[model samples]
Target: MADDLSPEFCAVLRDAFERAGYDADGVLRLLGDSAHAALGRGEPEPARRAARDSGALGSLIRLFLLGDTLPEREVRAILPWPESVSTGVVRVDGDDVRAGLDVRPYGDDQGSWWVFADLDSDLLGGQVPADHVLGVGHASLSLARATIRRPVGSVLDLGTGCGVQALHASRHAQRITATDLSPRALSLARATFSINGLDVETRQGTWFEPMAGRRFDQVVCNPPFVVGPSRVDYTYRDSGLAGDDASALVVAALPEYLARGGVGQLLASWLHLPGRDWDERVTAWLPGGVDAWFVQRDVADPDLYVGTWLRDAGIDPRSPEGSARASAWLDWFAENKVAGVGFGFVTIRRTDSEPRIVCEDLRHAFDDPLGPEAAGWLDRIDWLRAHSSPDALLRAHLRVADSVVLEEVSASGDEGWEAVVRRLHRTDGPGWQHEIDELVRALLAGCSGALPLGDLLELLAAAHGVATDALVVAALPLVDELVRHGMLVPA
Candidate 1:
């Protein structure tokens, strides 16, 4: 029996899978709409039934997606029996075949790749082992969509469970270094890259432990930032560290490991402790001379937070075991005085000047693959920083962004009508809305990039009987904010 991996083996396997039409689109087509929906809700029976008659495709689905036992003859038809047996991926038991690893197809807009990890909770039907490496999940997808895809010299995927982030980084980065605390996770990640015929350097370490004194042009991580009492069940989600300390450690250590002009994007959860501002608690983690933006997507109270994580670990919330686990989690949170948990994305860019930190709450849904939007934000921040002084800003020619639309709130009054508020709404890309006064709205609407901002402000001041200096002073701050948020542009 052959156990070793080679180019020839991978190519043959790829050809066979292609011939069987085993891919994301293929699986969805075979399963149809209803069964696909059922699988998404963690119910796989419908999918199993749907694919039971699809021939080789059915066998592939049963083996990988459903984790079912199959006849040895059928298994060998898809997988090389000698090599599969030698490698322990599948075993023979009474003329039946069973898998030790779960392999599935995952893809993004760029292309497709096969991902290998421990069987999911639905397939395992129990608590995942402590060292279980997770496959594609909400966290990994969030980080992937949030990662900046700009081509770079090098990138690091910290805590690279099953290496999905690293795999995504491979599309843009010339070189990728992936690290994981669990050796098994690292091995599995290596296998994942090998199967795809992509090269990535895998290191065994926790967080930044393996890359001492090294730096990267870009760093992407989906760390074990879950706020928990302990790391008892799974290493993929829980960090053993006290509430949100793992995220804190990552944030604190980033500046030292990021090259100048480097970018770091991470998905993290932080505790909203009582009597503390969420922004303050999070911004305190950033070191000096790094521009940081923290977009808090959602917040959950302690009870909901604990219960959600418990469910994520495969515990049924309505079951007796779930009740006990939830009680323990809540008790620990109460003892620690955690008021709530905040989940979001943190983007940091290393710069020379003092860090510009902006923490905002955006709870509404937006488009994914936010890398370009994020890169735009950092560029706008740099432009705003250089134009911090009123004189500098007023001398620059500006244009109102096309995506911005002016909207006003009004109410009927004794004076016939009154305007309560004027706001700018962005039509695309995160869709931010901002409130503006009459004067600022007039200035922005009138901007054509032909006249300098100082000249426009002076003309407006003359027409309104206000001092030009005061007008410039009052308008520059709001203009800067609008520019930084991409509502306005420098022509």
Candidate 2:
């Protein structure tokens, strides 16, 4: 009944569901029965729902999840969600519904790889089961988190499974177009939008097939980057192209659809050839005229890689039925110029200046960092694009903004908080962070602009005297913080 979805209303629903004592499955059943008519097909009731009190909240949650836009006040007053599930960008498209605590059982996260399903979507042209439409993995979220920024005009969420990134992006962009290869997934995305009340443009397509020649101010994806080509491109696994190059192919060709200053972020994996640098392999995926932040998080031994990939498709890693298939995946990697497999995140922005390519491995804990990190990435891309490398002087003086500070509040109020900023490429041209004391001193010392990072470390060692290696290793994160905070710029 409301015009825009509000966080408070969502919270209220979330809180009520917590007290209802219903498991995820139970609540879903109640929702099913209440919202059945809106489901279109024969939507199964998630529960028996022996109730005489199903009212506005129930109706709203169903309507919202099915894809309606409600007013802001309604959403906020419905309270119960924590920060992680709290609102980001998705605004109401139709009526707003509230799914309280019960929403959790319905969603999960995969570190590098796993299965994802949103019952809201329609898979296989609307007939496939919700479980059949797997959502994207953390690898993709990593990249999307790294590159996106605020104030983007319109965005295109490609391959939007349950509208994950699309839902997130709706927070900032005025308009969003979400596309998926499976109508099931699109259906679920629509449902998610409806439930959360986010207005988005949904389409069906393979890659950019549905929106050919269309452009957006920003684009994000979590494609089916899994290696080992599959005959059945179900909700989960697909290397789409050969030798897992499908992900690379998408990357290699992203520029065609990218706006002049638009940014594209994604998670991808690539093969490492016998004599080739993994860095070079991924760099090749980047199209011309784009600045890139590419991170290769982990690599696997061939057999290990094969087994791991197989397990992702809901196949048993140690089962006999999976052995031959897993072996084939390894063989494919070996036969196709692949020495080892590399998995990671990449953020690219179209720029006229010389492209910046940064490759690193960060397996550190990010701690609910999907929002601002991505925005920072876009801002940095703009900085790099505007002022090419061999940056004679990083002449920008800066103030560390409040949002730039991440905190760990202590109940005693006597606790300490760490302030971090990244000065990328400071270590051999990659910026460093002011993460710890040694790196902090090193970075703060560099404010004078005479000593190189290495020299600064040496000076610190001579003065306060810490081990050189210890200092060097720890300096990287600290320097990363500096660069991230705009406190330090490449001179």
Candidate 3:
């Protein structure tokens, strides 16, 4: 890529950003909490008012973020890097200076970093170009939060837009390679890595082509998984494949790129067809010898999905062109017998034993930064695999997760008061809630991590006047399900 972005220029840029305190915290401080929240909602007037009197940080925010032009002298005073103008980072028209690209502050719990990408379509007052590289967005952040961020020897960020995923991977991975089909995207990714002072290898190719014969310890992809007609209008969202094929292609090809025991996490979309189970369709995409978890976060009908993506490209749904596009999209959906679209996270880990794949819809809001939960889930899968037999499971001690809470429901009837329902609720990590019967409830109450599960089951069987073998057989599967959902854990 960006051949003009020399190391010296990037180094100078990083230093200038640090000196001016142009970071996540710095930006928040400059624009009070209200104004910052307003800015995130896409209303810039509040931020504009807040920055009118602020100094260099204000000008920096205006130039890079708010898409405002500033006095050339003021920009030069703050940034001594003459290469910015020479390299077309900004255009100088007489006494005015305007940024040519978008540079914003992004960070996690660790520290702050900068992301470089093309200006937003709102700033441009038009649809983005075909090869536009997206900055940090909801999908990218979702994948980042959902990734299992264990320390690894190497990582692969497939279809890295502005290298946001790669940037987060740098915190734990020893080495990383970011790839994309668009050269402009790769160029921006390279610039992002350079400015962050991270040693990431950038390659240009589609999907796995850039990393032929290479296996990575971790692979993270946010592919062009938008489901629609087989037409390519934008590179970031359209895969030019009909009806969710892009997502399926990536999932099918993942096994070849992951090393044994390595993990791959990606964001994907799939279609719901009439009389066909969505989970089964997606589950069939995975090859053998891998444990997978699919969490569907949202579902959109055809009309809503089409309208949302159309407006995302700056097209008004009422416009003639928008109407024509929608008609064609709906026609495609009708021909394909598509019912709806499902979007969510997919985490797969290569394994040596028989694979365990769980697919379910988790639409409830819960705690974010689910990386730790994801890692714990993979470990629990291994533990369950090691103890697949009844005897092995009975010999182990189990405890309810600290975040789990028990709720009992009751109603007054002719017999005064009677229990109606009982449920176990996990307060964190997707907040899964499971209804239980008296037997299961009693069994969970006895799981204080003090005795073996077999002993506890034996005690429950004696109290309930049921056979020990029968209770054990019935409780084993329930315990396995609870462990998988993070409602229970090993002592």
lDDT of 2 by residue, 1-491 (tens): 12122434444444454554333344445655454444334343432132223544443344233333345455444444343134322333344433321132233232111112433232211323323555444554565555455778889888887666776676679999999887656755665565555678888877888888887788888877766655444554463466667777778877777888787877787777788787887887776888777767677677887666555555665777677777776667666756777787777778887776777665544444444555565576556445433221133332233233322222333455443433322232112233334346434645555555566666676676678667666654454446554555554
Candidate 1: tens digits of C-alpha lDDT, residues 1-491: 11244446556667777889888888888999999889878788999999897999888988888888999989889886576666556667899887766778888877888876877776678877788889889889988888788899999999998889998998999999999998878877877788888989988987798999999999998998888786546888888997899899998898788999999999988998878999999999988989999989899998788777777778898899999888888888999888889998999999997678999887888774577778999989988888877778888999989888988889999997788989898887778889888788778866889999999998899888899888887888788788877888998
lDDT of each: 0.84, 0.56, 0.89
List per-candidate RMSD values in Å: 2.6, 12.9, 1.5
> Number of backbone collisions per candidate, in order?
0, 83, 0
Winner on lDDT (1 vs 2) = 1
Q: Which residue runs does candidate 1 get wrong by more than 4 Å?
A: 1-12, 32-38, 43-50, 85-99, 230-232, 318-320, 414-418
TM-score of decoy 3 = 0.97
What TM-scores do the predictions have?
0.93, 0.60, 0.97
Compared with the true structure, the alpha-carbon lDDT of candidate 2 equals 0.56
The lDDT of model 1 is 0.84
State the weakest 10-residue window (summed lDDT) of model 1.
Answer: 1-10
The segments of candidate 3 whose C-alpha lies over 4 angstroms from its true place after superposition are: 1-3, 80-82
